[model samples]
Target: MTNTALTALREPAFPDAVITEAIRWTEQNGPLDDAQALRLAASRTADAHEGITQRALLLGERIGLQPELARARQWAPWVLLGLAALIVIAGLGLAGNVVGGGERHINVIVALASLLGLHALTLLMWLLGLLLPLGSVNTASLGWIWLSLTARVAGGKRGQAPVLVRAATGLLSRAKLLPWAFGLVSHGIWSLSFTVVLAAMLFALAFRSYTLSWETTILDPEFFVRAVQALGWAPAKLGFPVPDAATVMAATPATPGAAGQRTWALWLTGCIAVYGLLPRLLLVLLSAAVLRSRRKALQPEWQEPYYRKLAARFTALAPASIVDADPGRLRGAMPASLPASQLHDTLFVIGFELPPDMPWPPAGLPAEFAAHAQRIDGSAPARRALLDQLAQARPRTVMVVCHAVSSPDRGTERFLREVLMHCGECRLWLAGAPDAGATQRWLDWLRDTGLERITASDRPDIAP
Candidate 1:
């Protein structure tokens, strides 16, 4: 992964990558020790904005696992919330209004049962998932997937997509941003939806009154009286009053009075607030706390060779080599363009983690390009390791093949600079048939870097 691609996939909420933890650690601990500083020059720098007379620091470059998608995912909760709110209002309106008949009355039993029962069923599902460890019962995961899909579909076309949508698409495309971004967005959206439901219920009940009664040809009146008493026990304790047995058993048509209806309404509303909304809000809070606590030991994954090599690479740089760069300002950009085909017949072809559709090491490539062209894959450490391998190969004139349509962003630019810095006399080859805009940017970037060798070549099927 190019250092630029590292920043490409960022989701700040979750603690996913090791480099993320390292940066967090460094931010808290100040600069690296001089011994480590001498080794990792990129980590240390005088604050570019603070002025040149500042202390040098050794901060490892951390990549955002879901960089592009961060902004897009931010819009998910609000959109889903709006949809959920409309559903809730429409549902309550329907629930409160009874149709037909001379004596107008709602089956309080059905209304209460449906509202409270749905929440109860949901909680039961969650409880089952927790106790049994069944992955399929994971409501949170399902919710996250739904939220992401909703964001993508209702989010508009990719080319005209909002910046946030672009961010989400970029990060999600790589699968790097999933673990962190999905969890937070799903839980938040779910919580917001429930909150709106509760608000709608409260507002609907406050101004209006509905006669609530239960009727059953098979069940006795005493049965419902006992059921209401039992159901309202907890709710009553929590300050919402429960109707007495006479009221519970009273058929509104025969008993023609508005007795105990308000208490019943308050009890149902409170049941939702206490049992439904409260639990959800609590879960959201707990998830937030869990997200924060995970950052406690923010360190890179030692087992991954990428992080280890990256650490060593940083530590190896001299203090004087430290460049004052800003992560926020350095987003390398190039518009995605047309697809390019297999690359061969070039002096050297070094691929930097192209998407899966374009197979690596083009089939039947000419021997020279095949020999030098390296398909570098995996994490930052793995790419750096490949760079080391490329340096050893020492091919004098190498052409780095990139997904031209993917465009030459800051990450691409940085990758070229790093490859040039190490491999020498490197040129960017736009593999596939990228449009003129993307091709021109790549050429312009090469010229800006003083490679002087700027040309657009669209020889598809260089397999010969």
Candidate 2:
């Protein structure tokens, strides 16, 4: 075929080897005359081009671009963490006001802070659950807890909850979920529990009071009494039935006296517990939740299926002759009639008979066959010498067949690929399937590497 016409029929995505093989076949077998061969090659090229184009279109339709929105959903955890931080900051400001004078301001601040902090912590726990090792204390216990809560809150199907839990656990075991799952579970448990405890303690301290006693006072009784009076507590002398200093302090800690000072210490302790412990817990949870959600969303669903399909499809298309190669012996015993014409053409077929009880050698039959066939047991070194000879001789084709031999090995395949690459004019056809998938895979490998002229015979007989 004219190169221009053949080029027009080529599919852009089809590997170059397929096109090369089609062209070679058409040139050799299409017709008796040059004109007819050219015409036939053009038609075959068109058919091949159409087949590849259709396959490409089908692949595109089956697998569309992954949705961007799904990607964003996976990253939602980061946003939640930011919001949690904002809530904690506002809570701190409100806490300051409450401690200064307004009880209402302080109460509002603490409540908001606790709520935000808890959510953030939960998020962190969820993220941790996605990462880390499965069956570890953190992965097994904490991962289960957060996922269970997530399942409940999300209203995921009851059946699915168990499946998701199992998947989450597997994520840890298989190293699929990773550091994300571990983070989520760890943060969630620690933050939630801490927040609840802190809130309870703070509520108790805000509404209660305490008292103190002194061993002696050098100042006049009225001095102490006036001090208590300023704090809105009525102080009485020790000589008469007096309002207990402890009770007065409890009633009004803000009063300007020793009792009020004691109240301030208790309040300060409560504030420190809430601000320091609560915010840290919230940050952990929120970070965890965000990470877990994002990891789940970003995970590629097509990864396993795609590779599985590729392997299966390649196996299915494997040349039949190779699959049927006998395990006990090479194809039928060597044919009796050795064609001299075949040998003269630089492309030939030779067959040999072997003893039935032959014990297979460790290096394989090909090494031994080389010695018997050519009077030279061209192992690796000899094989390389043959490739060098072939590159210089530049024969059109070479076909060798050895009986009672196992399939070719990596050395044989590598030799063939090198020969094909070096001697562009020569075509090599390797027949005999010693392994189920080995030959086709090697052929594909050659094709991928641009050695398209090499072909494997699928036919049952050799009549040449």
Candidate 3:
């Protein structure tokens, strides 16, 4: 079994998208055929839910559902990496345009806006998308694009690849993990872009000399001074120099002194670090933390009608092996029926379908009878195992104990008839405080099956 199958059967830690895709594949493919279904059912574990999950996974593996899902998963990270590379290139281009070109004149205000303006807008939009309850946020992300590209690259029309992609997005959206997941990728790319921008700016400043001054026709000089001081305050606190009023007033289209230019260059890089890169980096961490915390809740909807129906089918398949055709009576000669008045020396008592709360080998039974009794839950494997034991022992008399609360059915009748083939005489005992009608119902069922010699009672003693 693959890690996915193991995790799915053990807990909901299985990938939600894959779980949904696996289920979708099952839905599209229909139930497993009887032979395969019964084979899985026969090996059911103690936990019924786990048993069903195990069977579903086995069925998927047999029909090639799992391999298709695995193939799609293999291409996801590569698609994401390709998308990240594109974002990095776009970032470098934007920063190069702002700081590049061998020009003697560089506008300080224009440089800052060009570097950080779009980042601020997109960041605000991401925040708004998160606060609002809408699906729009999902599409506005690199993660969504990555998912689409992965599906397309893996052949979306082939097998269950498209279903896998849709399931992944749908589950993430419903679980509220979409925003954080998208934000994580988005902020990470933005951070990378800003890093590239800052690096380019620092490199250009170190290698090339340019005059740094603000240019405006409508805005007053005082406005520019306040703006430079205000923008520089946070960066200045962190040791980036802020140009004072004298430096700000001395501006022109011509190149400035080396000292003035140094102050302006540090100020530009500092603003980008504080306003652009730092916020995005922090958001990247925040998104990662949120996604990590909420990951467990991203499970398949087990209570959905489709899954519930599958659960019923799987449960039925679990104990279905018992319904097989009865092994013919005693190989050759039929056993002679012992009279009701006769008490055999060798007795075997079998408890079948008894309630969990019911006492085994009832309290008043003789020690000899109690010693020979064994209780079994109605599983096909258990029933077959017990039959094998009885065939070997070949006890002269066999009494099958049952809970009176359970109505007699064809399954019960077939199993009882098979038991009669192994022993000379067979008896039935419905143990519980059943009403008169319930007892009479069993009596009718017993007679109808042609096992009329076997009498049933609530009593524990075997006095016939």
What TM-score would each prediction reach against the true structure?
0.46, 0.30, 0.62
In model 3, the clashing pairs are none
lDDT of 1: 0.49
Model 2, span 1-464: residue lDDT tens:
11211122123322222222222233233322323332333334333234332332333223321121122223334433443354445554444344444332123224434434554555555445444332443544433444455444443343223333343344334434344444443444444444544455456545744222221236554544444334222111211123345533343324424434344334333343444454545545554554444443322221232222222222222222332223443322211121233222343222212223433221222332233233124244455345445434443444433321344443344334434432223323333446646556555544443444555443213223
Cα deviation at 241, candidate 2, in Å, is 35
Q: How many pairs of residues in model 3 come into backbone collision? A: 0
Q: Which residue runs does candidate 3 get wrong by more than 4 Å? A: 1-12, 25-44, 62-65, 156-159, 254-259, 319-464
Candidate 3 lDDT over residue span 1-464, tens digit each: 12211121123454534644465565666644645653565476744456556656666667666776666567766666677788778878876776675675678888788777878887877777788876666676665676677678876566666666666666666678777777776787777778877887788778987788877788888998899899999998889999898888887564355347788878888999999989988987777777666777666665443444444344434443332224442222222442333334678888888888888766666665666899888676677667666555556788888888887775676567557645667778777745888888788666655556676877767576
**lDDT of each candidate versus the true structure:** 0.49, 0.36, 0.68
Ten consecutive residues with minimal summed lDDT in candidate 2?
1-10
Between prediction 1 and prediction 2, the one with superior lDDT is 1
Q: Stretches of candidate 2 above 4 Å error?
A: 1-134, 139-142, 148-163, 172-179, 182-200, 211-279, 282-286, 289-310, 314-364, 367-464
> Residue 203 CA error for candidate 2 (Å)?
4.0
